[model samples]
Target: MLCKIPDIAKGVISLFASGRLSTEDYREIMQPQIESYRKSTGKTYIYVEADVLLEGWQHQSLAGSGQVQLPNFDALVLVGGPDWFGNAVRLMGPFMQGEVAWYPLEQKALAIQWIAARTDSCN
Candidate 1:
């Protein structure tokens, strides 16, 4: 399930995913934010909490679905997930156009701080 994490900050949308991730959930919950980001010229931020990496998800398809809008992101913070997932993202982070940070579940505050610093969102 994907649930919106509300009241975090202005211009920032946070989402939490549990159990197995679904493309349908992604579309219903996340795609709107991505669309809003794409339509707006203003800076915005995103935070995703998908702590576990469950089997049966095609990671590439989920990622590929957002490729067009990825470059327009102001900043994104991801909290938790497996070490390998974090490592893979970190490896590609430097090459991406926007700032991307990953934090352990315990360091969620730091992830919020990092993304807040990059956005004009009043948190």
Candidate 2:
């Protein structure tokens, strides 16, 4: 399950991944959001909550490669369980050059606020 964070004014794209995440799910759920962000701001600042069970080598490989093709962004916020959070950071680190922030699930709201503020300052 993925959702955009509410109340942030910038073109920030957020997603929450829960349970098993397949490649098809990634494409179906995330691709549209990425496209929407691109159309809105010509870039995307993606925040991902890592509460998912990642499966299949192919899915992981595709995710790793596909991230490189993502539109430019201002930042990425990763929030979730510690292990998954670490994994998410490791997987997505290379593709990210802008500010990157991470927080535990308990701190998601704060993370969003920080990201929003940071986005505002950058623009």
Candidate 3:
């Protein structure tokens, strides 16, 4: 499942991914949000919560496609397991040129706050 974080007031767009993620899920949920963020902020900062179930070749292929579809963002906050963090870093390396920070799921608030602050300063 994927969800947008509530209570974030800045231009930074946040998402939480849990359980299994599918290509259809990305098209339905993430794509529209990314489009909206681009239209509003010109740049986006994404915060992704771990607990993601990255299973199946189709799911992985969809994730790769989604990465290509994303707009240039100022930063990315990855909150999850170390393995997930490492995979995300490798996958997103090419698309990201700005700051990328990782923290455990326990530090979700800190991650959000950091991304918000970074986005603010960048703007």
Ten-residue region with minimum lDDT total, candidate 1: 53-62
TM-score of each: 0.74, 0.68, 0.73
Each model's lDDT comes to 0.71, 0.66, 0.69
Q: Which of candidates 2 and 3 reaches a greater TM-score?
A: 3
Error of 2 at 35 (Å): 1.4
Give me the overall lDDT of model 3.
Answer: 0.69
Descending-lDDT candidate ranking = 1, 3, 2
lDDT per residue as tens, model 3, 29-89: 7778878988887887788776746432254645555532445567877777546555767
Best by TM-score: 1
Tens digits of per-residue lDDT for model 1, 1-123: 667877355567788866666676666777787678556735657888776753324476467666323435778888887766678678988977778888988998888788877765433
- Assess the local accuracy of residue 100 in candidate 2 as a C-alpha lDDT between 0 and 100: 76
Candidate 2 residues 1-123, lDDT tens each?
444445344677767666555556556667788888778766667777766463322446356566324445667777774475567676777768777777877887898897888767756
List residue ranges in candidate 3 displaced over 4 A.
7-9, 52-57, 63-69, 86-95
Better of 1 and 3 by lDDT: 1
What TM-score does candidate 1 reach? 0.74
| Top candidate, metric lDDT | 1
Which residue pairs collide, candidate 3?
A: none
